[model samples]
Target: MEDVVLIYHNELGLAFRWKNTVPNADYERIQVVFRNMSFYLLQEEISKFSQNIRSAQFYNCSDCKANKSCRNILLKTPLEKMDISLNMQELSKLSDLVEGTLFKLDLQDYIWGAGRN
Candidate 1:
C-alpha cells in the first residue's frame, strides 16, 4: 500500500527502516554515483512499485540529484517534507515543482527561495 525510504547523509550505506504493508511486495538495493529505484537502480526487490515510490526523506543529505530530476513525478506523492538545510538551492529548484510550498516556515527576509536563510 504505502512505504517510506529514509536516507541519511551517510549515502544510503544503511538500510534503517524498510518494509511493506502490502501482502506481496518487493525490495532491492544498488550502488551508483546517483540512483533511483525506477531507472538508475542496479537492483531492487520492490520491482512491482519501483515506479510508484511514495515518501522519501533525507536526514543530512551530503549530496542528492534526485531532488532535481524526478522529485515531483508522483502527483499523489505522500512526500511533503524534505530536510534540505544544506542545499537551499535544491529547494529553490523545486520552485516550479511546488509553488506554494517553496518556503513557508521562515519568511523574515525570504531571500533564499522564500526563506530568509
Candidate 2:
C-alpha cells in the first residue's frame, strides 16, 4: 500500500486512498478496494453503504447442503449499481470495516476540525 494511506482495515477488508502528494489535494473521497472489487466514494456514500449493510437481512437455506459460510446474501451498493455476494460472516465483517472507517473519519474531523474546510 505504498501508493495509498490506510484509513482503517481488518481481516475482511480495508479502506485507503492515494497518498496526498499535493499540498492542496482533496480529502473528500477515499478508495475502498477489497473483496475483489474497488470503489472510489465520498464520505456520504460510505455512510450510506454502511447503513444499508446494517439494515440488510440474511437467512439460512434449509435445502442447500453447502456450508453455512456460503455466500447467500446479495447486498446492493448505495447507488444500486452493484451487487456484492456475501455470507453472514462476511457481511458482519464488511459492516465492521465500513462503520469503523466512518468512525475514524468522523473522529478525525471532530478532533482536527477537518470538516470546517
Candidate 3:
C-alpha cells in the first residue's frame, strides 16, 4: 500500500494525503509520521515560494476494513482552503492544528467511515 498520496491543483499547489498502509501501526508513531510529512511539505514544497498548496485533506483510500483515525495529523500551511472529514472529537483536535487562517473549509464527510465533523 502506498504510504502517501499527493494531489496537485494546477499552479495553486498540491496536497499531502496519508494512506493507511499499516493498519496495526501504533497511533503515536503514525502521528509522528504525519507531523513529519506535514513539516516537509510545508517547508519544502508548500511554502510561499514553491508550489503554494491551496488546501490540505486527510482520509483513507485503502481497502483495509479497519477504521483509521487521522485527527492527529497537524497541517501547517498558508493555504486558503481545507477539506477534512472527521468525528467531532477529531475535528476539534484538527481545529487546534491549523496555524494559518483558512478562507474556505469543508469538514463534511463525502466518504464513508470519515466520521462527521
The most accurate candidate by lDDT is: 2
Give the count of colliding residue pairs in each prediction: 7, 0, 0
TM-score of 3: 0.22
lDDT of 1 by residue, 15-108 (tens): 2123555344343332111122222132232222222222222233445556643334322222233222213333333222222211221231
- Model 2, range 2-92, lDDT digits (tens) per residue? 7678999999888986777746546678877668888788999999898778777545566788897889888888666688888888888
lDDT of each: 0.28, 0.82, 0.33
- Per-model TM-score, in order, reads 0.18, 0.81, 0.22
Worst lDDT run of 10 residues, candidate 1, spans 96-105
lDDT of 1 at 34: 15
Clash count in backbone of candidate 2: 0
lDDT of 3 at 35: 27
Evaluate residue 106 in candidate 3 and report its C-alpha lDDT on the 0 to 100 scale: 22
List candidate 1 segments past 4 Å from native.
Answer: 8-18, 30-37, 40-117
lDDT tens digits by residue: candidate 3, 1-117: 266544322122224345667465432211212222333333322234122222333333355544555343343443346432343344333333332212111221223235533
Query: Model 1 scores what on Cα lDDT?
Result: 0.28
